[model samples]
Target: MRAIQITEFGGPEVLQVSDVPEPVAGDGQVLIKVDRAGINYADTHQVENSYLSKTELPLIPGGEVVGHTEDGRRVVALVGSGGYAEQAVAHAPYAWDVPEGVTDGQALALVLQGTTAWHLLKTSTHLQPGESVLVHAGAGGVGSLAVQLAKLWGAGRVIATASTEEKRKQVLDLGADAAIDGTPEGLKDRILEANGGKPVDIVLEMVGGRTFDESFAALGRFGRLVTFGAASRQSAAPIDSSRLMKGSKTIAGFWLADCFANPQLLGGPLTELFDLTAGGKLRPIVGGEYALSDVASAHEDLRARRTVGKLLLDPTR
Candidate 1:
């Protein structure tokens, strides 16, 4: 089996395709013939050993894969690793049947990034109807979905932040009420202006550092800011308890891996996301697709903010 492997932690340059032995399925696990594997921004961090979770050496990069099982059942599975390969092992419980009318890339999108967007709104923020929501990196995979989901859930306003004008337009197409510049400079003011000179009721913040700071400052009373990723690779300032008390604000952290402990958390929302996609209510944007051997280029494009929506790798290529 050919797979992308990393023996050292650094950047996309560390990813190298090698003809490695195929992974074997363990107890309660099944072997998957990899068709498509989802590439996330977190995968970029994983390669550099800077993600929320630790990255072990001699590791394969991807965590979510859409493929067929030994029994010929098409499924999308959230594996620990080894998804950047011709074949991989999938834990049975973590795998779900890819419903009819859903493509492989769409199924892969719903597994990690899609579920993250869902949980960030439904579970972490406990978003309320008619609440104004701000989504950072609005053209990216999770942000694109979050914008649509916020609208579908009856949000009063959906303001998005994107790096480029084209990306902003894409965000708007995804149903954001407004799309603003993502740069930290004057970001708070832009967010407020977009929301009718008022602070947002909910924020889906992932970019850390100044982006996080600006988003936090734009939150209204009783606002919730959910931090799921730090794409900027910079830490935000320490939160002040007194300040939080003053505004009744909340700073919540969410990692999709945590949902693995409770199956319902991942499974339930995934079912909903799948149904929405099948019914044509939810659209998953596939920004780019690369061959398995081009995994390094995929990571590079993601880290450089040169891509949008979901990215995938075709193992058969």
Candidate 2:
């Protein structure tokens, strides 16, 4: 089997394609014939040795994938690592069968981002119907799914923030009531104006740093802000407890792995998420697809922020 390996932590060029022995299923693990893999900012961060977790040398950096399990069932799961390859293994407990009618690419796109957004909405914030939500990076992988799921959950108003005009349009088309161009200045004002001068109830803060502070200022009384990823590629800002006290607001951190560890708490939302997609309430946006050998280019595109929506790397492409 062939895989994309990062022998050293560095830039995109460090991701080289090479042949490797195939993996076999262990007692409870299932070996998957990988079809599509999702590329996230964390994957690129791992390559640059900037992520929260320690990188294993000669590592395969992909986190989420969709493919066929040993028994020929279509499935998707968070592999922790080793997904950027022709084949990989998934723990049977975490792996779920991809339902009929969902394409391999679409299922792969939704697995990670869909689960993240689902958990963020239902668990971290305990979002209520008819409440307002502000989703950052509204055109990116998780952001796109978050916007759609917010609306599906009966949110009265969904406001999304994008860094570019193109992303703004894309977010709006994905059912966001409003999509604001999140610049250094006037973004909060624009968001408030679009929401009829009302503050938001829940905020999905993916872009930390300066934008994170702006998100803090844009909240309503007793609102909640959940931070999942730092796509800003800069230092995160210090939190002022006093500032949070002013609005009686709350700040929380979220990661799928953390939620997955407590399955009893996550079981409900995970079911709802897959049901929403199966029922046609949510659809994933696939922006680009690359072969496993083009792993370098995939990282380059994600790191440069040139790609929109979910990026999938097909081992068979």
TM-score of each: 0.98, 0.95
Best by lDDT: 1
Question: What does candidate 1's lDDT look like per residue over 1-317, in tens digits?
Answer: 88998899988888888889888888999999999998988888888888878978899989989989999999999987898998989779899999998999889878888899999999899989999999999999999999999999999999999999999999999999999999998999999999999999999999999999999999999999999989888999988799799899999999999989877788899999999999999999999999987888998898889999999998878
Q: What are the clash counts of all predictions, listed in order?
A: 0, 0
Q: Write the per-residue lDDT of candidate 2 for residues 9-80, one digit (tens) a residue.
A: 899989888888887878888888888888887898889888877887989888878888767888887788
Candidate 1 Cα deviation (angstroms), residue 70: 0.9
Model 2 misplaced regions, further than 4 Å: 263-268
lDDT (0 to 1) per candidate: 0.91, 0.83
Count: clashes, candidate 1:
0
Query: What does candidate 2 score in Cα RMSD to the true structure?
Result: 1.7
lDDT of 2: 0.83
Lowest lDDT sum, 10 consecutive residues, model 2, at 262-271
